[model samples]
Target: MKSLILYDSMGGNTALVAETIEKALGARAMATDLVKVDKDLDIDVFDYDLVFIGSPVIDWLPTKPLMDFVKRKMKAYARQGVVKPSSPLLPGKFGVSFGTFAGPHIGEKEALPMTMWLNSFLEHLGYAALDQWLVVGRHHHNKEINLSGRLGNIEDRPNAADLAVVEHKVGGLVDSLSAWCA
Candidate 1:
């Protein structure tokens, strides 16, 4: 099925997850496209059967660019012909939300709510928000908060193990999507 992965990252952890997902989908994906959300993003979310969105959680929220993309795209999708009159998303579309966070205060807990917010954007667009993924990243801004350097020690977070998990999740999601697409 056609798939799209959109991401915005500051610390690079979220970008790694996005790239991993793109690689895992590979040739099985009819057309897999990866886009880095920015001020000039020009995309049609309704064009894809499956969409994976990710961002770095900053201050308990998604990066501003990612949030802006969703808001802008939702308006654009509404004006598109393929979007059903009674539905928010194109029929038969699905979505997944993911994020990375370096919360020295609560570690992975900080990533959860942010991912949920990202998923809600898809939900509002009538897509069945399928899953949410979170990855721990090294905290650079506040070394004091990361006293133990717990997650900070890992030089390259969203590292091999984290990527492997992404691959596995993508495989599972594709399996389920295949059944639905068929």
Candidate 2:
């Protein structure tokens, strides 16, 4: 099946993960529609096989724009109805949430605050979150950053330790999504 993956990156970390996923899924996946959250074509989410979302952590929470967008989308969906009978693909629609951040360690619970919350929202709304990824940085330097988040996003330039933690998080997320997709 095909899919659409979109993300907002502050230090290029989130974008890196999105592109990697596109590569992993190969030709069946879009491979190119990696739109910045604020600048984009209007999302006709139902037209795709899957729609994946990514963002950056801001103060240990999801970027505000992402929250606003999700709210808008859910409202639109609820007003329009969660699923349409004529569109079977619409019912099984899958979502994935991710983020980039520099933060206090949470040991076994390595996660960006915003992404973690978004994952819960998706589940509570009854949508399946297939892939979740988190990219990290230790400092706030764009020279070390490579992407955008929050619409007006934040970039946490990572220290060596932060980079290592992000790597581990992404690995676990990849496995999580793969299992769910299978």
Candidate 3:
């Protein structure tokens, strides 16, 4: 199956997760495209069977570039009249939303809104929601917050162990899909 790892990362946390996902997909022998969300990005999400969208949480929301990409796709889908009421699922198409957050106030709770928002958009476009992954990230800009956050001392997070978990999740997802197809 074809897959796309589309993400936007600030300070490299989310980027590391995205890369791990890409490698896992590769191991599964899926044809996957790894793309970083940018102002000039013009990708067709429908071209892939599975799409993984990720971002780094900024103030409890995804980065503006990734949000903008979603909005642009929504508009384009609307123009084509493909966005229907009740958003029926599109068979064989799936989406996974992932993100990195340094939840200073509420721990991982800070990443929920961002993940749900992205998943809702994918569902609105008829892709079945497969999963949501949230990883702890260090708040690099603020030394105090990084040390004092609810998730304390995450300076080395999204580390090898964290990425191993992500890789395992990806393998399980691919195996599930393979079995479903079989």
Query: For each candidate, what is the lDDT?
Result: 0.81, 0.57, 0.92
- Candidate 3 lDDT over 1-182, as tens digits, reads 89999999989999999999999999988999999999989999999999999999877788999999999999999999989899999999999999998877897788899998899989998999988999987887887878888788888888999999999999999999999987
lDDT tens readout by residue for model 2, 28-131: 33333566676333675555545667776666666666667667776777787864434333255566786665444441134555676776656645656665
Candidate 3, overall lDDT?
0.92
Instruction: Give the C-alpha lDDT of model 2.
Output: 0.57
Candidate 2 Cα errors over 4 Å, as ranges = 27-32, 39-41, 83-91, 104-112, 142-182
Off by over 4 Å in 1: 27-29, 78-90, 142-153
Q: Of the pair 1 and 2, which is ahead by TM-score?
A: 1
Native-to-model Cα distance after best TM-score fit, residue 73 in candidate 3, in Å? 0.8
TM-score of 2: 0.62
Error of 2 at 85 (Å): 16
Query: All candidates' TM-scores?
Result: 0.86, 0.62, 0.97
As a whole number from 0 to 100, the lDDT of residue 115 in candidate 1 is: 84
Scored against the true structure, residue 105 in model 3 reaches a CA lDDT of 84
